[model samples]
Target: MNRETLVNALLILGLLAAPFAADAMGEPFYVTLATRIAILALAATGLNIALGLGGLVSFGHAAFFGIGGYAAGILATHAFNAEPLLFGLPGTNQMVSIWLAAVAAAGMAALLIGLISLRTSGVYFIMITLAFAQMIYYFAISWPAYGGEDGLSIYVRNAFPGTNTMRPMSFFLIAAGLLLAGLAFFALLRNSRFGAALQAGRQNEIRLAAVGIAPFRIRLVAFVLSAMMTGVAGALFADLNRFVSPSMLSWHMSGELIVLIILGGVGRLAGPLAGAIVYVLFEFALGGVTEHWQLFLGLVLLCVVLFARGGVVGLLAGRARHG
Candidate 1:
């Protein structure tokens, strides 16, 4: 095990240990906090696929995240009310069903968004994505069926096969498991042929095209896959809060996801997890200290950007070697 591997392993172990330790000490709130870190990390991991590998600076990922949240909220609402979703498709309280719905909905949205946004590059791409996200955000706010601006509430947590998801520990384990799976997927993707092509396009699109590779399709697929992953995280988040609102679709949420990736280590496999841990801890500790905690947070982010370009993981693991 090299330094990077060791650090990554320690980070995951620490995340797992912290929650269990908190639960053992009867500090359920901390378990919830750890779960938030895992969910946010999962969302950031999705963004990392596009941003890190494909070099796509998508500023509208919140659209997918919100879509997933709404999927959960709407599905749970229909199930609670014993109503059928469109076309006689009954609402489901099952976590598997809700996750499938979330992934499908978000994937479709990503397809449309990627088809249009992928045509542009650089700042144009970023702005186009952001614009699309804002459109959805406004739509969510104006649509009153599911509480609109106030957001929709789920009366009960979604059922996850045999597991007592109502228990904080159980839910944390589920979220943690997903996070681990996501990390593993990310690592595999990074080493696969598709990952190679994506990174090649990121480095030199002209060269990739010369080799008969289509950068556009590769990027679009990456974007859609990224959206699907983030969407799943959104479903988990809604279950954690038992609420879904337009706020989930806001640009701020998108920005925060990017921040999580950057803070952890932009292209590093464990970047999202590292960043989420630091971010959540900062939020918890600073909020308790002062209401104007954002000011301090901004300063810390500035330092990371200027001095710790590699993020927390980068700082610990050394700069990654590019081929």
Candidate 2:
């Protein structure tokens, strides 16, 4: 196999082996860590579709992520209370249902946000998105139903078909499956005609316009799809934590998502995955080594930005044109 194929193969093998090894070692914490990697990676993959492919530097993606988390939390709480969701709609605790709702909510929000943001470009676009996210964050904090400033908690982990999701390994596998599916989607999109247009629009919008293609529409579509994917990750994350709050909608969450992309190498398909892996590892390792771990993380992030350039993926795969 070529280098890329060989690297991917090894990575997949390592991820597949992680759960079993963690179980054998009688250490469930690592399983949770691995799950966090997968879920965050999935979220980053969604952002990559827009930031990497469409060159849309959205700063409000956390809105979608928070929406997804709220969807999961709200549904679980209502189901636990045996209350109706809305218009007498019965609340459900199924993971699939929660994910679907999260995706829908995020997609809808993206559509609205993209319509207005796409009218502007560059700094204006970034600031607009950030403003929208802040609005959502403040709203979540003010609203009391789903725990406003306080977060909503799930007493029991939600169930999935044919699996005891409460089990660490089982849930990890579920997250892994979602991650694999997301990767497949990314590959498919990257190779498709729309992907070509989106990438082209990013590289040379004027040329694309010369060819009679509207960069605005293409980017808007990409932005919405990106939000939807991140939304799914948010749903999974809420399930993982069994809690949801305004914190998920905050600007810090948006910054963290961007950090994942930049640290991994922007635009690379596996960049987010690699970044999530390294980021979590840093958090875990540094947390153990020092009380002021965040200070070290900031230092490391600065190094990555200045020295690494393309990110971990670029370091591994050679510099790509974008990322």
Candidate 3:
């Protein structure tokens, strides 16, 4: 196998193994930590489709992330209370149904956001996307139905068919399995005709336009797909923590997703996973030792930007080989 493939395999296996090993050692905390890595990595993978593949640096992705979280929280809350939704629709504690709702809600929001944001480029695009995110963030804060700024909480994990999601390993497996599926989609999308068009537009919009391909359309579709992926992660995250809040919509969360991509190796299929691993481990290990842990995290990020521009996967597997 190629080095990149091997490295990718190792990364996936390492992630799956960490929690199992932790469970063996009676370290449920570490297993939970691994789940966080998986969910966050999946979110970043979504961002990578826009930022890395389509070359659209979106700063408001957290908007979709939060929307997905709220989808889960709101649905579960209604189900628990046995209340009907706005349309007299019954709330569901089913994970499958919740995921579909999250995807549909986030995708619709993305369609709206993309229609507006894709009109601008460079700094304007960045600012407008960030503006959209902040608008949602404030709306969440002011909207009292779901606990306003205090956030919404799910008293119990949602049901996932036959699996007992309350079990740490079961939940981790669910997250990890979704992450694997996301990665597979990434691979397939990257090698597809649509992916070629997206990347080509990123490289040269005028050329793509001359070839009768619309960059705007390609990007809008990609942006929507990206949002859907991240939205699923948000659902899983809410389930993981049993809580959803306005905090998920914060600009900081968006930036964290970007950092994960940069740390893992932007555009590389396994980059997000690698980035999430390092980022979470750093946070977990350093947070316990120092109050100013962010200072060190910043330093590490600086090093990555300055010295290892290709990121962790780049360092281990060398530059990615595009075929």
Cα RMSD, each candidate: 0.8, 1.6, 0.8
Q: Would you give me the overall lDDT of model 1?
A: 0.95
lDDT of 2 at 135: 96
Local distance difference test scores for all models: 0.95, 0.89, 0.95
Cα TM-score of candidate 3? 0.99
Error of 1 at 60 (Å): 0.5
Clashing pairs in 3: none
- Candidate 2 regions exceeding 4 Å error are 321-323
**Candidate 3 C-alpha error for residue 237, in Å:** 0.4
| Candidate 3 accuracy as lDDT | 0.95
Segments in model 1 whose C-alpha atoms lie over 4 Å from true places: none
Sort all candidates by lDDT, best to worst: 3, 1, 2
lDDT of 3 at 212: 100
Query: Number of clashing residue pairs in every model?
Result: 0, 1, 0
For 151-247, candidate 3 gives per-residue lDDT tens digits of 9999999999888999999999999999999999999999999999999988899999999998999999999999999999999999999999999
> Per-residue CA lDDT of candidate 2, range 1-323, in tens?
55554555666667778878999999999999999999999999999999988888889899999999998999999999999989999878999999999999999999999999989989998999999999999999999988889988987888899999999999999999999999889878988989889999988999999999999989989999999999999999999999888899999889888888998888878888888888888889988988888788788789999899888877776766432
lDDT of each residue in 142-216, candidate 1, tens digit only = 999889999999999999998999999999999999999999999999899999999999999999999999999
